[model samples]
Target: MSATEDPAAETADDFPAAPPLPWRLDGSARLGVFTLAQPMEAPSTVTAVAARRLLVFANSYRGGDVSYDALGVATLARHRHRVAVVPRHLWVDDPSIRRAGREQASTPSDPGSFAWSDSSARIASGQASVELSWHVRTRLALPMPMTFTYFVWDDGRLGCIPIPGRATGSPITMRINHWPDHFPELAAYESSLALRLNFAMTVRPQRLIDSK
Candidate 1:
């Protein structure tokens, strides 16, 4: 036997407590991280870890690259979430629908011009998860016959799947018990760096709600 305590036996008390909600990052370098508050403007730094905390404040409603009046989300190593920010593009290809065009104020009817909003665990499970959801208001038509996908954390592994109904709407539903064993290496590479969201909707949704 040695005369030292086992380092692995340390309890929660051994480490410093985590900061409460709306806490500052303090001094961590925000290089690859991004926060979207508008579709055509720039994203503001809500919390910067430069010193203690960098709290970003805004009242413009919309400033980042999103389609709604207000667009904002928090991205961190631990978690992330979003509300009212529609995804402009999807990195992974889904077999449910075909790309018509891109989102634009000029080409409203072109499918290629529209991006389907999505959800995230961080954004939905606010306690300690990334809950991402992009609301498309009551005017624009849904991307009918589309499928949304949600990618969960795989201990730094890459993966993708259909967005569950809970993350999307009542008519849709999905569940994932474990991570895929063989996700494409290309996607896995990106997952190691950051979390991304992609959504699919009907080009003609019957009941678009203004949850905002």
Candidate 2:
């Protein structure tokens, strides 16, 4: 009944929740930018079983409706990371998730692309600790936009990239969410621009880990 309450707004008495639990790096790949243009790479493939779920994929270009990230999943089954709420548009009918045409299935001809965005994920808690928040909105500017955020730690590794400052056709409203109970009261926010960014998140020491 909490986790920011939105498992499709839960109904029918609500009872269905599972995803998260895969540590030591089972899935993770990220990239983000603020004002130099060219840094939107993404991947956090899957970590379902209860380490508080996680799944991400990005390739969006909000300004003209050009999306190519056919794979974006999020689930934080437990272990804190609470305070959820970020749903504007995120659908494909679940069906155990397997719709290749945009992005998620690494190869097999790679053809995944869908435009328009607005996404959410939330969970918050305290007394010891727990937090999770995610946001993505799109219209590309002139009315809407999109970006991502992830913050899950207590040892699972994550929390650093926070870029917000742009100018390439300004008109922004970015808010990348983070977990640990939606810390500092909904982290990251901006309306205009002020420009000041420098980012890095490295963990490629030797990657090739995937558990199908």
lDDT of each: 0.20, 0.25
Error of 2 at 131 (Å): 24
| Worst 10-residue lDDT window, candidate 1 | 101-110
Q: Which candidate should be chosen as best, given lDDT against the real structure?
A: 2
Model 2 scores worst on lDDT over the 10 consecutive residues at 20-29
- Total backbone collisions, model 2: 36
lDDT of 1 by residue, 1-212 (tens): 01122323333444433222211111101011222222222123111121211111011112122122111222211113321122222211111111111111111110111122342121111122122222222332233222333222222232222322211112212111122122111111111122122232222211212121
Please name the candidate that would achieve the greatest TM-score relative to the true structure: 2
Rate residue 37 of model 1 by lDDT. 27
lDDT of 1 at 85: 21
Model 1 scores a TM of 0.17
lDDT of 1 at 28: 9
Q: How accurate is candidate 1 locally (lDDT)?
A: 0.20
The CA lDDT at 99 in model 2 is 26
lDDT of 2 by residue, 1-212 (tens): 12322334333334322122111111111212212112222223323232222332232322221212222333232113422211111233222221221112211111222333333222212231221222333334232122222322212232222222222222223333442332223213321222111222211111122232
